[model samples]
Target: LVSYKRHLEIMGERNSYSKTDLDATFMRMKEDAMNNGQTKPGYNVQIATENQFITNYGIYWRPTDWGTMIPFLDSFRERYGTQSNEVVADSGYGNEANYAYMESNGIEAYVKYNMFHAETKRRYANNGFLVQNMYYNASEDYYVCPMGQHMERCGKQHSVSDLGYRSEVDVYRAVNCKGCPLRGMCYSSVIDRRSIKVNHRSDSFKKHARELLTSERGMMLRSSRPIEPEAVFGDIKFNHGFRRFRLKSNRKVRIEFGLVALAHNLRKYSAILSKRMMGRNHAYATI
Candidate 1:
């Protein structure tokens, strides 16, 4: 990761947007992933196609897809040095940051967030909760429970599920969740308050999150990501038997993914070739 960043001349300090710091953070994550045997803080390789060939592609190592838009565009620009004119991505990459980046970079981007869904609503209803049912209180810098319960930030150590590193965190819990009227909908614990665990160094994260959530384009972009990325994955994993990782290490994984992408392009090209052979003015040709 460090070598790639240096070679690309992409990781660097910025006046308004420090690309170096961002790259450094991503590199750290990659290192962490390598050490821990996880994909967290990793880069994703994307291949764009037209007429069954990879017209453009890139590797983005940002923590979230939202941040990848600008970097992807920048990388594309660096590679082709030409404007795509129009771009399309999923909701994960659709936030204000990405849209603004697209607009600034002279690319018209289409991205959608997964804002509303009947299935999601139904599931939440079953659980008696809704999206953002749990949220952080910025003014007080604490987490607010679903049932309007405020959990004060307690300087305590607690083990959170899914966090690879065992670290201390600020714990917040509903003061009187046990006796609260909304207990049924809020907590399954009677003896303890509704605890909301947060990392100690979470200010920047919180800010970025708010920016992603508040933007209209963010939501829109998220919606497109699932469709586009899912389609890409489905073609690779389901159709091409790429469900298992064929190689170890980031470099090998990249090569393997590239080959899979190459295969996909070849298939697409074959279809086009077959159509062209049929006739220029024929129905197959049109297809």
Candidate 2:
């Protein structure tokens, strides 16, 4: 009991920690060697790229990428003393809090939210049971369910994320759903009335993001996102064979990765310089 208590004290708020590296978290490793999805001690690294160059980066202990976006951007701003005019990322980094941050900071967000692609499909849009598909009376602040029952806003539910971001969702309940035949199809609540939670602010953010992400410039930028960050990761993992970190602790790993980022940028510059030199040599030869 004493040994377990000591270990728990050392772990703190984290679920698991590596004894070898106190700062390292035991997270599920992406590359499961035996295909059993084994856990390994590692850190989640977030990076922003502009034209294939690493503009900013942050090391986070959080396994989920959604919560990392805000902190990563904050670090980028602190380092550069300015925020980027526009940001583009995958659905994993999209959330209400992240969108709000970008909006308040005046950064144009071309980020995709969860189920963004799925929501664009015909089935998703045509589904009557979906809260999004239901008729919403903005003037009265109420929703008309698929059964034509008025769902009035009852109250608000407030919750906080693990990262300490507070958000509120409005709860709407139908007047009576006891006799409705579609009650089973809509909600499975034990109560007679059907209730649903909706965050109008989040919905507004998502709507705006959809517009930005679907634009011509946004499409061009989105198409190149994979080539930017993913390509760099591929080069680091496959081409450069930098799969495992030689450093033990998070602070040491950060410094090690800093060198890696610098090296990648230097290699790109060298390649560009070599190409220019070759072009000059060809021009002189032709002359």
Top candidate by lDDT = 2
Structural similarity to truth (TM-score) of each candidate: 0.44, 0.95
lDDT of each: 0.56, 0.90
- Residue-level lDDT of model 1, residues 80-150, one tens digit each, is 87868766554566454555556667665554444423334656546534324456667887666666666
Predicted candidate 2 versus true structure: per-residue lDDT over 40-94, tens digit per residue? 8889988888778888877877778998898888898899899899999999988
Off by over 4 Å in 1: 1-43, 51-53, 60-63, 114-229, 279-287
Quality of model 1 by C-alpha lDDT? 0.56
Which regions of candidate 2 are displaced past 4 Å?
Answer: 1-5
Question: Given candidate 2, what's the lDDT at residue 56?
Answer: 82
Question: Clashes per prediction?
Answer: 22, 0
Candidate 2's displacement at residue 139, Å, is 1.1
